[model samples]
Target: MSDQDPDIWSGIEDLWAWLDSHSPGDGQQSLLLRMLKLSEEVGEVAEAVIGAMNRNPRKGASHTWEDVESELCDVVITALVALRTLTPDTREVFVRHLARVRERSLGPGPGPRPA
Candidate 1:
């Protein structure tokens, strides 16, 4: 993954800006719609993976692991789009969420707290 290119949260910010410019009416887009779209992208990834893994390579049908990976990226993009639609400041949200997860993973620092 290129550091120059925005990661998922940064992608969300970019998507939010695009939506801001386009002004998708009333901000009433359904979450189900976004999820369904993401699912479709993921399905493509799965299909390509299955083809590459199980079927013999043919003359015209060139399905490879790379194709599956690209489709998986599309699924990630779709997910970022949905996340941006839900939260404007995805970076901050992600940072905070990450901090919480880290804290949980690390547990409370050695203090007077009981085991």
Candidate 2:
């Protein structure tokens, strides 16, 4: 959190612009494609995790933890890009939703103790 750090919203905006400009389809179709990209990124993450865990006998230890980490980044980037495609106010939308989620799980008040 410093002046040197790049703003995430700025990066999101830049990515949205780049994709929107290069996209072959119209707006609606492009948005749908972006949404589908999320699923693809998530699948990659799952594949990376499975490979790292050696969960698949046929491809034991095929991926390293670094690969899993990179895939996780891809999932985040894809999700953010999809959100940006859905709306121009991506930062506000994400922040409000995140606040609501945080409040629901860990609100301003404390919970009852275990009996």
Candidate 3:
């Protein structure tokens, strides 16, 4: 996962700026709207997963696993953008949280054991 990619965050910031310019909402409202977008993106991921799995009888295998992967990327991008909306220092916040999660899950070692 290229979560550390500078270009990804740069693109997200550009998108956030464009969105803010177009929508022109207050801070709290903007944050709420951004947060809500996460759910929308998450739903798209679920749809893609179902399509890839051929779960829908009428539209069997309508989407590929690649499509599901793209949708999941969208969900991640949406989540990161929402986090940025809450604070300008989203990278730091994310890195800190990731560290905590790593410590908890990996016990401060080389990392979690492979399954």
Sort every candidate by TM-score, greatest first: 2, 3, 1
- Candidate 2, lDDT over the whole model: 0.91
The candidate with the higher lDDT, 2 or 3, is: 2
lDDT of 1 at 114: 75
Model 2 lDDT per residue over 63-105, tens place: 9999999999888888999999888899999999998899899
Pairs with steric clashes in candidate 3: none
Q: Model 1, stretches more than 4 Å misplaced?
A: 1-11, 19-26, 55-62, 99-115
Q: What TM-score against the true fold does each predicted structure earn? A: 0.61, 0.88, 0.84
Point to the candidate with the largest TM-score. 2
Q: Where is model 1 poorest over a 10-residue stretch in terms of lDDT?
A: 53-62
Distance from true position, residue 87, model 2, in Å? 1.1
Where does model 3 exceed 4 Å of error? 1-6, 110-115
Candidate 1 residue-wise lDDT at 28: 65
**Per-residue lDDT of 34-71 in model 1, one digit per residue for the tens?**
76788889888877877777653463345788898889
Query: Candidate 3 lDDT (Cα, whole model)?
Result: 0.86
